[model samples]
Target chain A: MAYIPSMDLVPGVLKGDTRAVARLLSRAENGNEEGRPALEEIFKRAGRAHVVGITGVPGSGKSTLVAKLTAAIRASGRKVAIIAVDPSSPYSGGSILGDRIRMGELVGDKGVYVRSMATRGALGGLARGTLEAVDIVDAAGYDMVLIETVGVGQDEVDVARASHTTVVVSAPGLGDDIQAIKAGVLEIADIHVVSKCDKPDADRTISDLKNMLVLSLGLQPHVPAPLDVGARKAARWQVPVVPTSSVNDKGIEELLKEIDRHGRSLKESGEIVERQAAIAERRLVKASEEMLRDKLEERRGELSVLLKELAARRVSPHYAARKLLTESGFGGDK
Target chain B: MSVAQTKADRIRVIVAKVGLDGHDRGVKIVARTLRDAGMDVIYTGLHRTPEEVVEAAVQEDADVIGISILSGAHMTVFPKLLKLLKARGADDIKVMGGGVIPDEDVVKLKKMGVAEILLQDTPPAAIVDSVRRIVAERGAR
Candidate 1:
């Protein structure tokens, strides 16, 4: 039997012990009975690495894009950690596990570490325990972390909550995708990608993005978009609309440059710190909610009786909940 | 918590998606089947680094860790996971996986610390059986 440490492994990680780092991360994602105390220690040491979240439709060549991005980032001499999220069985709470096959080659590279996680019935479109996973990578000494979300729905904006930069990918000939994103999806993007630029319509997609950016920024169409107009100005619209073809490897370098530039902008604009603070705050609230949810479930038998009474019209759920809260010694007050 | 569990007894497994490729239908089915078979399955949801999956294995005290990879990243994800298992002192945990893998690579995966690789289109029962053998060999209580 392997010697299992009963203590948090953060100190070992800080000392550059990869094994300890890995062990702590595993514990974190398990949400094991011991996870919280372990994470509390690692959490204080996090925030050293840059986190990037990439999301797009399934057929949008996300894996290819990630492959190319990994190569580019690796070429720049940075160690990269990628967290790929795949679909999971809602019933069994496990994954179908296909993402790894697409990213095979990059896996062999010394500087790159790739991990796949199933979206195990987590609300908000991310896998449960993802932050803990990111903490593992961050603590593992990787300079950059890439989070890839399964592009099932628009709710993937949750990535933005954890990452310092959010990349939303779309392909040409996605006919109404641009229009679809306008409603709510596009707003979360720090950068937008027109993938598969080898196609003829890719340029038009880029133009459409420029137009959309102008409109969203509340600028006139005739007014050159901020990035284009300020191409020479010291101050510029940090956001860049990029065209990339993971197939031909076109525009990938430019895309990386844009991503790096945007990272700088996020820092220059003071958004990175603000966003990280918000993410941390959201994480605390989520942790508290999960803890509370477990507590409530522990009293499920009592709650069910109250719910049944409410259902029978003997009392309102709100009133009953309020009463329960009172009995539990909570005021339900702000 | 019986010493000898029925066929319906919960077989605890950790199903994880490894790498940046995001397809996961197969892993989900296996998790569901194993659960329906009365196994306790802990799913380390997406974007998990390999370390996270192994950590989950130890924490769940799982008898097995099932890795599903379709992103072509299996070469790195699996070997690293095994290495970490050994490094973190978890060589005893049975490691298995399946998903869009070529036969040649499956052989390679199995040689590299994976006890079994459940291929795409594999019958769900085969996966369950593989888990059963692995669990039995480990004398999982």
Candidate 2:
């Protein structure tokens, strides 16, 4: 299959050509080789957009809140791009219900670019291509990039590591209170939102989250050194549990203000640089691992032969691996 | 070819609704069926224009563009879509349609380069099969 050259696409992407941006994102999602150089070229132009990740249980009104937030962001004269990651069908590797329907009105708006991504069988609720897509949007000069995850609890926490600020969305009466207690979800929240506040139980959910945050923060003092250090510093900015109802457009302004507050806190506290450094580190490590895996897969034939020998008990698995490594020049002259 | 091989080479289809038709229930069902059948389906939610549909198809590199129009505007929408696809150099993308389409218009749509036209009553299984067949034919081409 012939791919579009990075030379042709990178300029268009940098110029904010929507078509070019979409094609580059597709290439990234499919892992096309040409996307790498384009991404590399655009990486320097990124880091301007604020990346926010919103995640919650399946019916927690996450998309509606995203739609509201996108409008609020646009009202402030800032361009926004949304990456809604939906779960792919395990059988077909495709998705049916995307976040597009909830946020359809934003589709035709020039200031907004909405893209739906399927998890593509990735274990994490966020697709493998999500971060890359976010970067492309950022390079295209979007002021904010909101990533909405599939809300499968722990697996979705990867979004926290990907975004500058993570918003954990919950709703009253959806057993979302129980779902939020799943450890990874609550620990990652810089902002806690209790959506569907029109319901009677909304305040209860809000209080429950506040209580949980208090408990989690209380326990942070006992956490180990380096890990607790960031938490202790981040703890200065209290995690606000805001109640919102998209149905009535309630608390949206408050949520937006809280988001701005968090952004400001991160910048003032110098956590923004640290967060970006951590993100870069993670990206580098992931890329290196992928490269090593590809190199090993290229030697699959030799590995399979060794696997057969091991199956026949001719050699132990460890010995076979060591011999293969040595033969492949990876054992460093041993 | 094995089922695994066929699935690995999954067909990517964009199931779109053009004009002001809000009756996407059928299209959604078809999208689900095609997805279940192992084709990557991108559903451009309701009220899309022909230009938007073609642009999305081009960017997505979709194998098929299935337009589900219920608004009696199929005559205008389908031809406009064909023209847009040709103008954008995306004539290689197969076009299909369903929902409230009459029998006589079906022939016109086919002549205008629609790969298949399913009536409102067409079964989900048939929709899935026709898409697979059309994509296979395109592959042969």
Candidate 3:
């Protein structure tokens, strides 16, 4: 059988065909240059999925929690797609994507799709394919899209900026911690999950997180200046620390309910617009950086030509920079 | 999540075990060999059924499904996986296996659409070359 061209994959993807979704997703992950147009189309058809980002430390039970959360979401009769990200080998550029093992028998379910990603040279707990893969699943008609990060510590906040709702999972007995490595991670969460609530130290973990949230909120109370009374009230969200245990299915439903509630509040309070705007800005900047990198790779010869001209005292740096950008199609002829 | 993919069409294979293949040292070695050869290998650990294996390969969009079995269930395992792959419209993914098996059985399995099966004595380097040839052959088609 011949390969299905990337251009021909868009229709089936738009209609939620699992085969097409799987194929297009592989192309996106590989950064296939042929799939760019189809990706743009996917971007247009997205925005319906409730993309929730879940991050935590290595032993925080993030995968088990994601598996449990997928079950809860599916129980509600919704379609889901999970992008479980693991790190790639920097030396070999090959990876064993074993996230499917912890996903707990989710295979063969038409309503749920689980994909394991390798962060091929991508930093901040995400692969470069992550953002596009989310859009592909979103256009494929999944009601919920869950992104499980590479069990991050502080400064892996890319998941927070990339998601509509960020849930940070902090397990008990992780260490004697000043609230899970202090503010960089704690401040990014729209929801806090204290996993292994069945353990003896669970309460302390919960209380520690609660105290940190309160102290942090007090330190920077209402940083967005002042809006009207209704807007301010709508914008203000009290990030709840939900305790959960995948062991006995404890608090899973409450976590799902809180997720739903957060989704609704964002919509009702008009904060979804602001959140989407911020996400779009981030996407724009990321795309620009990627394109610039690609252009530089494509125009290495042009750079050397400019060097030759400069060595001969023929052209200035400013003129040469503009010439390269124009020739590389960054800006219109001006 | 297959950023597990195409940095210049690097071969992606799902190396798995189906049924009660209680031992896995060979499979683990083969997975590492393929990875060391610059291939992305999704190793689905022991106790997988044909349905589960096919589902994984389809979802992962792998170019091949390499089953390593030593429990003397190759006859039942390979045919069923091929059937499931066909039913799911993913027969495009090549299927192969390795374990202790007789030469005549290898012929029959090959006839039944198993791409290539390496007996126990086959080498690690040959295994890597076979996979590369298999994927390269598929591309040539």
Worst 10 residues of 3 chain B by lDDT: B1-10
Q: What is the lDDT of residue B88 in candidate 3?
A: 87
| CA lDDT of every candidate | 0.70, 0.78, 0.82
Q: TM-score for every candidate vs. truth?
A: 0.73, 0.84, 0.88
Q: Name the top lDDT candidate.
A: 3
Best by DockQ: 3
* Candidate number with the higher DockQ (1 or 3): 3
> Candidate 3 on B35-101: residue-level lDDT in tens?
7777778887788989998988888778899999899889899999999999988888999899987
- Candidate 1, superposed: residue stretches over 4 Å from native: A6-8, A15-19, A219-236, A323-334, B1-90, B93-126, B129-141
Q: How would you order the candidates by DockQ, starting with the best?
A: 3, 2, 1
B-chain TM-score, candidate 2: 0.92
What TM-score does chain B get in every candidate? 0.89, 0.92, 0.93
Worst 10 residues of 3 chain A by lDDT: A225-234
- Sorted on TM-score, highest at the top, how do the candidates line up? 3, 2, 1
- For B1-141, candidate 1 gives per-residue lDDT tens digits of 111111122355778876676777777788778865546566665667886677656544566888888888888888888898898677888899788788898889888878998878888888888898887777622
Model 2 CA lDDT for position A78: 93
| DockQ of structure 3 | 0.42
Interface RMSD of each: 9.5, 5.3, 4.4
Candidate 3 achieves a global lDDT of 0.82
Give stretches of model 3 more than 4 Å off. A177-180, A222-235, A297-334, B1-7
